[model samples]
Target chain A: MIEIVSAERCVACDKCVLACPTNVFDRGPGGVPVVARQEDCQTCYMCEAYCPVDALFVAPHTHPLPAGSPLREEPEVAGAGLLGSYRERIGWGRGRVPGARLAVGPDLDRAGPAPAAGRAPAGPARGARD
Target chain B: MRLDADVLVLGGGPAGAWAALGAAEAGASVVLADKGYLGTSGAAAGGGNNLWYLPPDPGLRAAAIAGRQRLGGLLTDVDWMARVQEETFRQVNRLASWGYPFPRDASGQERRSSLQGPEYMRRMRRRVHRGGVRILDHHPALELLADEAGVVTGAAGLRRQEGFARWEVRAGAVVLATGGCAFLSRAFGLNVDTGDGHLMAAELGAELSGMEFSAVYGASPEFGNHTKGLMMQYATYYDERGRPLGTAGPAGRDLLARRLAAGERVFARLDRAPAALREAMRRSQPNYFLPMEKAGIDVFTQPYPLRLVLEGTVRGTGGLRLSGEDCATTVPGLYAAGDVATRELVTGAASGGGSLNGAWAISSGTWAGAGAARFAGTRGPLPPPGALRPAGRAGMRPGGPGVGRAEVDAFVAAVQERVLPLRHNYFRTAEGLTESLRLLDPLWEQARDRLGAAPGDGRTALRAREAAALAAHARWMYRSALARAESRGVHRREDRPAAGPGLAHRLLVSGLDRVAVRRDPVAPRLLTGAGVP
Candidate 1:
């Protein structure tokens, strides 16, 4: 299951909504994003990882397996290099694979809008933390 | 500052959503305001409490009715209760039919049950939206407005992330669906709950029905304040020999079922156990507690675990007073539901998903809201200039996020010095709670004062959220602990050890005009009825 987004905690900043690989959230008229399609959750913790406020929780899925930093797998975009090929092989939209585990991440941008300003470097920052 | 909606639901959990949807479907222009985001209210959060009393067979229907009848005053109208039950089933069924995966039971029946905690939250949130409940997140209701005759007019609150963004929403009917005061005692340090809905309703002079029956729940043992792991991990309390303690029965399901049927409230106490069972518990790996890495390995292995726990965490059962069907207090137009309302037949074992019970709240909230709206219509909407400041608005001094090195250092020292290792569990005494209050209050205040500017732009807002929750928590604990001369259910009193007579069914009400406590007058054994004592 996709983690819970403390929507109350959400600043309506649209960071995760824009960063999503799928257009899962539809920004409502009131400026908050609506869970446009919750069923599409691939159980990826990307949204949680990227949530600066730590307002999300992905369930039943284990936390990133304990490992030494840097080498530790980033939850959603685990294998970016692999994901790129997977998306291309399936001929899915930008960064999306036809059926290969459609969780909340993938460096592949997919069908969503451009990533937010501070979000583009998520991979490197994640790597740096590792 | 002025806003318009056909129906304004004060809370955004299961009850609020159902009420909003029903109102909207009934052709009301609906606006739902939640202090938290969608799916995070009393219903969604805290392991949703949607429970149905199903019989092992059709023959047990009579048994169920008999059980209800035996309880008498303890039992809500079975027909009305059944109506709430049917509506809940319909809503859950509607959610499942929409493709949300609600796990089925052994009989392949839609479990139609809320295991409780965050898992239930996720499911209910998904289900509410899938069911088309529109929500306005982060809008916490601050005040319930009333006119000259004490009729409730409307409500107002602030936008958390947005500084000073105030909203005054006018509704045809206003439903107070805000969840109860658990976050109050745990966080705020107040003895009595922060009294959000109660305070607002009191401002309108609404007569709260049951102010004494406090909704009590055990704090998460080991993991201070987390309620999830207890629900999902099904952490069974066992002796050193691995024999289940308390209402011991094999398996979590069997034990819980037996306890509830017998009207026995469940509580978890820490104690030492044999190495074998300790190892088994260790292997089971409860999630809510601090990881062994943090609290220490023996944390789980030890007996009489000295930790704040989460068990029978009542969100105020005998807390507020209210009449039947009408979630109304003594004051007209002011209504309560979820945790803030009355804890009657709907409380304890009769509930399921927190939000799933939105139907219950909706029935009451709708009546209250419509009544309030009708009242408002007579007085006319409070003019834009007349928008009232939210009642109970504590103007907290702003500060930065992340405790400072000095504060952290002080906290560690204080914990080492004053934090007793004794079972500082819920069985509170006047001196103990007072001692805790004296020790913890200064630290909390000092931290709030000394902390530099809130770190992030929204840090001030976040701190306010934390402070409000903390204040409410402190108020609830101190007041409830002080009020209850005896211990019962979740509220264990160290001063008065055993359950006293004549106070069991008698409800407790805080001066705030909400039902604060409800006790069975006499133990069940003493009663002619069939309820468990």
Candidate 2:
């Protein structure tokens, strides 16, 4: 579930509101989007990924975190660079290499000569960059 | 609000986007109504997808088709496979021409066979807009409208962003690219994929094919919601005693499922994966590793508990049956595409997994869109509102007064119990299936007769419809499973341990209150040139 939307870092761009598939966020005072329907968050991280200023923090838990947990304010959490990490990983914003450049196609030879009933070849090998 | 269009495409995933583009290019006025934001909605928007992008090399294409023929239970159509390959090849290159930023190989040649989900959908949404298609984000179509002759003419839905205001679109034709049902299993980005299209189309007398194969499952962390199973190919499984489970390769899914069914805690480590590829995996699928990284677990080395998340018809090969190569359904002016249409034409009884489905979405979406455009062109003009009748039954036009919130919640929970468990869905038996039906049948009755929402409460109405759709979907799946008494592809019936020669036909399922199933034989020509007996 989403944990926080930092007011200081937020640009009030409304990108997260438009990008969220479930409409979990509602634009609030001062143009900032509040997590109005936190329960509807599917934890897909689209809000975090689309945030331009890295203002959002989405915990990986499928359910809501405990109230007033210190983990929300821990420097280690931010120090570990978990905030807006999905955007960085996908090479989305500034100074990032596009992740689309890393994708590889399937090797046709792996289909093999003989038919393997009930066992189709696995999809393209993930992370096979080399 | 009332709108008119030459074509009204429902659900704004890859299929719906492509459909809108195809219709616009054909000079049809198009309107795309999505249940959520276009670029980020549906299953394809949340993960990387591989396309079946075989070049026009006859030998390679022939080899690709033959390899998966037997695996698909010999129900695949060779011509359809070739057509999809050809169409996918054309479309991806077109995307590249439109500046899709495809990755280059070591030799600097562009690789057009794979796609990053976020980038792909973002580009598709932009292209659809540029093509003059009107997009209505956060608009969920609740029902289809048919004319006096029973021809589907338009649809009615609620604008969820506008205080549940009613919106209706009268179109010359309609295309349903609404994806498939995951039974609310929380598979990544599939929460909105509740078989809405299937239920709406079925209400208008459309049949579903290969629903028996709806038991597909993907491995995920027990505490997380990501269902990307590609990384698990290299992982090794262990039992609660820290002993190796000895399950190897994709064929070992049955063994792993059996152990899981026996009440054993299953754990896995990606120790077998090449260390060099870890960074690339993170780059390729960033969301897949987020849960583990946040929980401070090294998935590459440390053991983590795992469970199978049911993907239902989303990954499984079953949905609205197509009656033509143009992707039209049995109902006039109604067409199906993407996961909403059965993949038996290309994938047969097996799941498309990613590649085949990705390609099918592009190919079928284009075909269905153009087909719908051509269909609308033949009709002179949109029918008058008086001539059209709303076809939605269970939720839209309930037989009795609306049920309460508690009843709707109970219906969803009851459905999850019968459908989500691996023991019930994966390791199937006649007794287990019959027992599931006994419980699910009455729920269908309640959904059809009493399950409804009070006026102006769109959220509750959507939930009610979703509950009805899930129940309707489960009944179709179990009834089809019972009819196909064989262990073929993903429809594994433990009691019938072997595939029956006579059961080689695709099972067609239809009906509302009382579900029914029948065998539709594959044409003899479709079975040839694929090494089938």
Q: Give all TM-scores, in the order shown.
A: 0.58, 0.95
lDDT of 1 by residue, B180-257 (tens): 543332311111123455545544544433332332333233323333322222234543455664421123323443
Against the hidden true structure, what lDDT does model 2 obtain?
0.83
CAPRI band of model 2?
acceptable
Runs in model 2 deviating more than 4 A are: A68-71, A74-76, A105-120, A123-130, B521-533
TM-scores of chain A, one for each prediction? 0.41, 0.76
lDDT of 2 by residue, B278-370 (tens): 776666657677668887889888988877778888888899999999999988999999999998888887778788889999999999999
Model 2: per-residue Cα lDDT at residue A10: 88
True contacts kept of 1: 0.00
Of all native A–B interface contacts, model 2 reproduces a fraction of 0.39
lDDT of 2 by residue, A93-125 (tens): 988887777654342222222223454454211
> Model 1's DockQ?
0.03
